[model samples]
Target: MGLFQPDTDIFCHRDALREDYQPDEIVGRDEELQQYIAALQPVINGDQPANVFLYGKAGVGKTACTRYLLSELKSDAVEYGVDLTTIRTNCEDLSTSYQVAIQLINDLRGSENRLKPTGYPRRQVNEWLWDELDSIGGTIIIVFDEVDHIEDDSILYQIPRARANGNLKEAKVGIIGISNDFKFRESLSSKVQSSLCEKELQFPAYNANELRTILRQRADTAFYEDVVPREVIAKCAAFGARDAGDARQSLDLLMEAGDIAVEQDADQVTEAHVDEARAALERSRIVDGVAGLTQQGHLVLYALVMLHEEGKTPTRARAIQDRYKIVCDRAAVDSLVPRRMRDHLNELAMLGIASRVERNKGEVGGRYYEYSLDTNPDLLLEALDETVDMVGVTESIRKRRS
Candidate 1:
């Protein structure tokens, strides 16, 4: 009775509420959501609360959950006449203490330019941060997403420790930090850990069934009538759970599958549509990974991918250096040759974009092998194309045609 069965269109644009549709919403985590709400009740009712820590893997609803709860809590706090001011900034973006303070001040003041005027100095920024919190005379919540990124511990220590140090004038401060580093929890010792981890919530990756349920809810809201089959949603759930169980990735796959069906004029979404969706999402992932690299790192990776695509890949530092030289000339940037390139290559290796392999000289002689891009060269290049300011090579090959 349907327009097309699962086999009708390879895939259907799910009428389900699309996640990438807007402000990354929280699909699941009902229990976690409740816990977060309960924990914040102290501050919401005008009592200064303990700092909280939320940690989880990528796409496991860490940012989405905390953000959603915070959004809702903000509205409730305002209605209750709580002068609750909050500022959320990712530590990864603000790697240093100064940057964090700048963002915090800018948020409190509601002016990015006035965060710190010329020649104010970092110490002054810190002072200003404390002053602003103290002046509020109410509850202030500072949420640092990816708190592990903060190289300077002062930001964490000073805020929660202000009262203990007798530095508070009136207002009480609480911090809610979010991080994905599994080992980061153990890294913190008594004092700072005690304060920040007052309430700890670990968000685990969603299982297949859980993802399916989530997608189903989203699909029902986002897609048209009965266009997407249950099979397609399950496929996405299984894929996400198997591979790092990233919800964001699954969401991307679902959205892309819909676009594919739309392009082909398919009346119904089928297994084939799911496959196409996965492929498109995979390519997008590679591109996003590459796009995030710094300019020099981007060039190094681009050169490596170019070499590998042509069949001259899995190259040594010297060989990669030679290839990199061409990329440099093309980009019109003065480039490094061997030694300098090694550092960049190592950096790439650390990022999981490039991998290092050990080779032997003569039957386990002095060891030295080669380097290779961990991801597909073509995919990485395309990914970089989206982010890089001036990427020339649309397509590069390692070998010539017959």
Candidate 2:
């Protein structure tokens, strides 16, 4: 047999668990689906389109739900004779209104008539966009997935108000702004908020039960009978719930488990494979997160990791700062001030690399925070070892720990 021999024993249809695969029925989002269907009801009634804002954490089914529902809406619009058109784009890299506008125009215009990504005034872009919408001459829903990445509220305010402001004569346009950032809505200007959030919908993270149902559904289609046992499914769902109630994470975990089983030439995926897959995913996440941090951030996290190994953690910021200074001195890098160090600590916590807790000392010491490594210390040390200039610090800490 060749080294790359096809193994059909594990996954019958592995692509079913992929990110782009849309399930026939969204298994766990009944409530959100009903509310979502209601939100799009205006499109079917030939009335003004509804401007909607969808907010949720990553992998909690925001984009999946949007695509699924839009598909259904389009079918219904055809049957009901409601002129509806939906255009979708992901704004993760589209940082400004001009970029987003250009993207939308290109998406509508197709490759032959696509405009350049740069070199156009904002007003001209808006005018072209309005002209395109007017030419479509019906209800148009513009879905901006990861919409929070756009730096300004200019596009958000402009698109929804296009028809009302007379920029669009025939097409009634609505905006569906989807974001994983919880604070993006509050960060928008008041006018943008009122205009874009006219029909706000929230997709809460999936609970363990919901995740289980979803995993099981995918497992049945993605694998042969009994290839993925119930315990493996449960374990993946539990891990996902503990992580963030993210369906995408859960699904990815399941897929990774299958891959592990295939690598081992195992007959079925087991809980052991699930555990191994979880650790592998976490290690990659830590590596990526650490790679994104600054030099000071690395030192701060290394200090916290050392403290954790020494059993000095759940310790306060001052102690970590002191150790950070020591790490910096040993590496010949200047230490930042305590205030700036604390900011790095906060950023680590936000990244899920560290955990923070608030402590009150009865108004005498006032309120302070205690920090500790939230991830595996060994994994963090390994990541630090790979980072520039941190190898010495990481080796020293490993020696001390050993």
Candidate 3:
């Protein structure tokens, strides 16, 4: 066998299909682009920047559109002789308001002058942020992507009301809060909500045709001319649209399908390649979702799978709690209280590992939630077995069956 395949030129520029790739153009977001442009128009006209909020499901074009417009705005600002400075930070790991402020201060200051990641009081951090903004002394737009990750809404309130509160004297600041959590906006305090949501835009998921267009555009640049066929692109789009209209998913499917074709020594990516890629993606997703759970979460999920295997699915929380207790006992770990157990179950449901259906018997019976495995029970068991020690768990399950 040869060391390398003779025909492995599946992708031209694979980076084009990646999540971080910032394309020269954004597709299927014309309306959104216009709305975003309108929101940032003030900065172009040398007026005070507007606070804008963007909310949507993951893999939508929220970040992409924001980046595209911000880039264009920065370029135009230079041409128009506007002193525009933009700061962007992802709050995924930086949760608290103080942490976000420290990050912003460090971002404003060069790395040489950056402060430590911790040890600052919230008030001191806010003072430092104000000082940095005052030093910039121009139109400053700060974008907080994954803003919902922030533990406190203090930064949101502080930034938008900086001028009115007299914290910012020279610089005019704008806040752009981006989040995939829809409820995050409403969860904010009324004051923070009123200011941060001054102008709000929602990015809806892309449909099949829209995803197809997006895939085609990236395919032209990502893969060889004939490597990805029209049907393959359509299939990828169909899958993404059927699920969540996630453009990222569509692009990922295309990229992975091409890689699979290359791995199999196939001449080109075909429907079979896409099918294999879909299976691989699903497996990886389930494993990642399972791996992210806490130990108790794993116990709860394992219990659900065991119940499902015994044809006890669509079970209520109380039944799952009982099974969870057994699994925990077998593993020699203490089980959580029923209330906390319910919280863990809800977390699992949020992570897409489990499903919760609300049930109400007529006025005679009270309402209850029915829980079931959202994914394949076999797959869930496989993921758990691989990620954690299931020897005792499997033995306990077997004993119960016997």
Q: At residue 139, what lDDT does model 2 achieve?
A: 89
For residue 397, model 2's alpha carbon misses the true position, in angstroms, by 1.9
How many residue pairs clash in all the candidates, one count each?
21, 0, 0
Which residue pairs overlap in candidate 2's backbone? none
State every prediction's TM-score relative to the real structure: 0.71, 0.91, 0.92
CA lDDT, every model vs. true structure: 0.76, 0.90, 0.89
TM-score of 2: 0.91
The best candidate by lDDT is 2
Stronger candidate by lDDT (1 vs 3): 3
377 Cα displacement, candidate 3 (Å): 2.3
Q: Write the per-residue lDDT of candidate 1 for residues 270-379, one digit (tens) a residue.
A: 67988988877667666666666677777888788777767776878888888788888888898975777888898777566788998888865677768887766556
How are the candidates ranked when ordered by lDDT, highest leading? 2, 3, 1
Candidate 2 whole-model C-alpha lDDT, 0 to 1: 0.90
Model 1, runs deviating above 4 Å? 1-27, 75-82, 186-190, 287-402
Candidate 2 per-residue lDDT, tens place, 1-402, comes to 676877788999999999999989898999898988898898899999889999999888888889999999999999999989999999989999999999999888887678998988878888998888788888899999999999988989988887778888899999899999899998999999999999899999999999999999989999988899889999999989988999899999999999999999999999999999999899999999999999889889889988888899899999998999889988788999999999999999988999999999986889989998899888887887788864376777768866
Which 10 successive residues of model 3 have the least lDDT summed? 390-399
lDDT value, residue 40 of candidate 3: 94
As a whole number from 0 to 100, the lDDT of residue 399 in candidate 3 is 68
